[model samples]
Target: MKRIQFQETGRICQVPINDIFGFMYLATFIYFLPVTGIIFIYIAILKYTKRSLIIANVRQLGLEQTRYRRELRFIKRILILISIIFITGVPYLTFFLQVNIGQSPMPSYGHRISFMFLSCGQGLVMLLAIFYADDVRKSLRNILLQKLPWIRGRRIGNIIS
Candidate 1:
């Protein structure tokens, strides 16, 4: 995976609690990606520009850098897994892009079955990643707390309280 500078830091400065819950609620009203992007930007601004706000809100919200980082990592893993599924399957999908692939635009029963299986595979991968991610995130959070004093116990319970 490509490593970004901010992600390298053990501190997660991404989506805050309000944004997390907001996204959950927004998902009910809006399609996910756009709402998620807006939420991401909102929290990112607070972390980067509104330092005072974070400091003021941190205590009440019980947000620690460690928890933020853990959530960020979990989000990152899910995105990566989804991306991998998309990229790996792109070639197969390209066949549909053409006007013809020695067949009709309408897919055969076999093709539909294959497509459904592929979709299921992607869904399964995402589901597993979602379940496993919590464990991986907690392990990383603990490691960061133990290894980095400045970050250790700095947040509420090393994750979002």
Candidate 2:
């Protein structure tokens, strides 16, 4: 049997598959479960309590209402983005738990694809930020146009000059 090497100690430890599964189950139950629960609770508090408070205060701000409303909208967009990230992350977590704790065998391709999906979650958050914020979109457009002038065609050159 091929032994798994420990990276930190550079030691080759012969650990049984069943023991590994038990360790994973305990780790996930003790660590990941509580952490995930806490995050969801925090998000719920932000969405229900803090959001309403901000909206109420923004309403009473009179002259600054427009600015405050815009800021609030941006914050709401960020919250939504966070929620999407958490929702998407559940699948990766589920797959990880199922494979590690449940001792269910996953195909190589399935593992690779699950990892890829998890990696892409951050990219999705960035995309949400870019798409939701007009200021960011404009800034990105300007930077892209400056770096790759050909993207804007002749009209952009004329405008720039």
Candidate 3:
């Protein structure tokens, strides 16, 4: 097995990849995990309340209902995506916290699996948004059509038809 040497203590330790990532999980749990959860809650409440306010004012203020609704929906989707990402990271945080506090032994594969899920959460949410939100789908489609020649022709043909 591979090992890392420490000069200060005159000792060499064979730290597995899981142990290395376990430290990262602990660090994230101590530092940013709570912050992420708090921000998720804050944004969720703010967005939904703001959406309600907009709905209440639409009739009296003669706001453009369709535009407001679409914007609100987009905001809601973004909040949901953020919440999902934060939730996915919670298990890793809990596992690391337990290990750090000596409540449980170091997890063999759970840390790596949770880390993978946490890392991919943002990209997964974005992909889901592309399918869930009309605005995102249209924007991505337009960008792809502009940058790729073959896709452009096919998309244009489909649009025309």
Candidate 4:
């Protein structure tokens, strides 16, 4: 039998994360594109909502104002979420930019920081979601009730909701 040369199943099976080309293309497609799209969508929403409020008839002014306030709050929450995600992603991006591929050892702080962000960021995001989303909270309560029969508690009003 011919000698089987093996390192991986394929020579190019995995893209090195620090590879400049891989990083650029992946970041462009995954990070920049989605972030820019989200920003544009929020901008459009805000502009359209403002226009609608401005053009509201006297009869519907109160309703429009309520709508405007609700939309504004939603937009604010989204902005917070975006900020959190961005903040969490920064260390990784910084590390990516700081390191030259295969030239020197990658910084240990970069790996640590990225790991911390990845771990804590997910929990923070989930907490934000739980706080903001009434349905998610309700579902979690229901699941807890179903899974743990021993726990007995009266129905409680949702403070956030």
TM-score leader: 4
Q: Model 3 reaches what TM-score against the true structure?
A: 0.50
lDDT by residue for model 1 (1-161), tens:
22222322224332222233553454345434744664576566445534644664656554555555665665565566555555544543454333144554423333344346567656877666655655766776677667776765466444522
Score each candidate by Cα lDDT.
0.50, 0.61, 0.63, 0.69
Compose the digit string of candidate 2's lDDT tens values, residues 79-100: 6766766766676567667767
- lDDT tens string, model 3, 1-161? 33433323323343323365655665578537865775777677677667767676856554555655666776676677767877877877677666666666655665566667777875787677667866766776777677776765465635522
Model 1 segments more than 4 A misplaced: 1-63, 100-117, 133-161
Off by over 4 Å in 2: 1-61, 130-134, 139-161
**Worst lDDT 10-window in candidate 3:** 7-16
Top-lDDT structure, candidate number: 4
Give the better candidate number (1 or 3) by TM-score: 3
Alpha-carbon error at 3 in model 3, in Å? 14
TM-score of each: 0.34, 0.48, 0.50, 0.66
**After aligning candidate 4 to the native by TM-score, how far in Å is the CA of 14 from where it should be?**
6.8
Backbone clashes in model 2, listed as residue pairs: none
**lDDT score at residue 16, model 1, on the 0-100 scale:** 21
lDDT of 4 at 119: 64
Question: What alpha-carbon RMSD in Å does predicted model 4 have with respect to the real structure?
Answer: 6.7
TM-score of model 4 (CA atoms):
0.66
Query: How close to the true structure is residue 13 of candidate 2, measured as C-alpha lDDT?
Result: 41
